[model samples]
Target: MTEENFLLSRVKRFVGSLAHCRLLGVTVVSAEPNSLCLELPYSEAIVGNPDTGVIHGGAITTLMDTACGSVVICALEDFELCPTLDLRVDYMRPARPGEPVQARAHLFRQTQSILFARCEAVQGERTVAHCSATFMRIGKDASPKAYRDYITSGTAMENS
Candidate 1:
């Protein structure tokens, strides 16, 4: 596989293993060394306005933030416990009812201890939200199982 393909596989596996991502029904659509795309299927559970049937803003924020974090993982050579230092999301418009939302995140910069990423959430051709985030890279400290191994294992689960 090419480097981009490998990164895509790893990201798919990584995102698949997260319980929160699972709860949100987030799935990887595409991935690369410095970028990732994810999708959130429309569900009643995510709707915030009953009358308007618009999805919640918090859901979009979560989707964008998670996408940003996932891209950070792809940018790093190995797994590290990267935590969010700051995240800012600007809502452009409400997502239409019954339409799946797609979030695409790109890593803009990376250093030994920091990573910067930007993301956008789109439904079809309409842009719903955009986000920018910073993550602090704490050195790897997991004892038994690295996150990379755990994530790659998710692919095996997919095959099963």
Candidate 2:
């Protein structure tokens, strides 16, 4: 398989196993060297304003954060732990209810310890939000054993 496909598969598995994120239904639609696209399913629990039928800003932020981190992980070709140092988001429009939002993120640049990325949330042709983020890459062995175990187990299942 191609490298991009390999990384995408790995990310899919990792995200699927994250119980706290409720990421079981999310899917990685595309992945390249610098960019990744994700689909977030709509749920009433994630709604910010019930009257407006809009998803919360925190939910959108989580999408952007994960997308950026996935870009870095794909680029590095390793499951290194990277934490968001900063994230700035601009809401262009409200996301609609019952629509699965698409999040696209691109890694703009990276240094030894930092990676910069930009992302956008879109529904069809309309832009809902835009974000820029910085991530601090930790050491290869810096991740906790629980995380390592989860990822490794998921990776094995994905490869099969």
Candidate 3:
């Protein structure tokens, strides 16, 4: 298969394996080269404040991290692993309950071993949160055997 096809398949499988992600009702809307968009359905249980029913900060952070990692994988066009080196999130406004949020990640650049990404979570036209992160690409030799096996077997790695 072509590299682009291979990376897309890998992203699909990885997203499926995330149980918490599944519970959060996250879906991969689109992916291309160094960009990806994710949809997250609102859940009452994820609310931090019952009075206002605002979504928890942790939940938003997870979405950002996932988006960044996916961007790295798509840009590399490989099943290689990349881990978050740093993540900084700024909440501009509270995400109200009962509204779906969309997260879009863009890879700004890559230099040496570091990949830089920025992501934003939005509800309709309103911005909910913004995030910036850096991911360190793990070398081929450092990649987990399961990932290597998937590439060899021509099956995408399900998850970690």
Candidate 4:
């Protein structure tokens, strides 16, 4: 497979292996060497204010965090465990009811053991929220084997 296709496959596997990602209905929209975009389809289960029909802030936060975390796999040459060191989400507004949210994350900088990323959660042309985050790099040896196995090699779990 080409590099783009290869990384995209790995990212899809990595995201799929996470239970929370599945819970949020997150899916990979696009992936590149330095960036990836994920989509969170709106569901009533995510609405915090049922009367107002606004999606929960927590759901948006998870979407942003997942977007930031998933980009680490694309940034590193070899897959590693990069746990979020810090993430700050500034909510500009609640997402509209019944509208899907998309978060695009970019890996802007990294050192030997840390990676920096930023993301925006948007619904259509309007921005719902934005965030800056940092992640600590734990090499493959220290990372979870399940995640590593899922993202690399040939046996990714279809329903994981």
Query: Which candidate number would show the highest lDDT if scored against the true structure?
Result: 4
Ranking of all predicted structures according to TM-score, beginning with the best and ending with the worst: 4, 1, 2, 3
State every prediction's TM-score relative to the real structure. 0.90, 0.86, 0.85, 0.92
In angstroms, the error of model 2 at 118 is: 0.7
Pairs with backbone N, CA or C atoms under 3 Å apart (clashes), candidate 4: none
Clash total of candidate 2: 0
User: lDDT tens digits, residues 1-160, model 1?
Assistant: 4877878877877777678889989998988878889999999999999999999999998899889988977888876658899999999988999999999999999988889999999987899999999999877664124454666443233233
Put down candidate 2 lDDT per residue, 10-91, tens digits, no spaces: 6776666656456425678888788899888888878999898888978887787778877786677567878889999999
**Cα lDDT, model 3, residue 104:** 93
Give the poorly placed runs of model 2, Cα more than 4 Å off. 144-160
Which tens-of-lDDT digit does each residue in 70-160 have in candidate 4? 8988888788878889999999888889899999999999999889999999988999999999999777889656657677764745554
Clashing pairs in 2: none
lDDT, residue 113, model 4: 84
lDDT of 3 by residue, 8-49 (tens): 666666776678888887888777788888888888868888
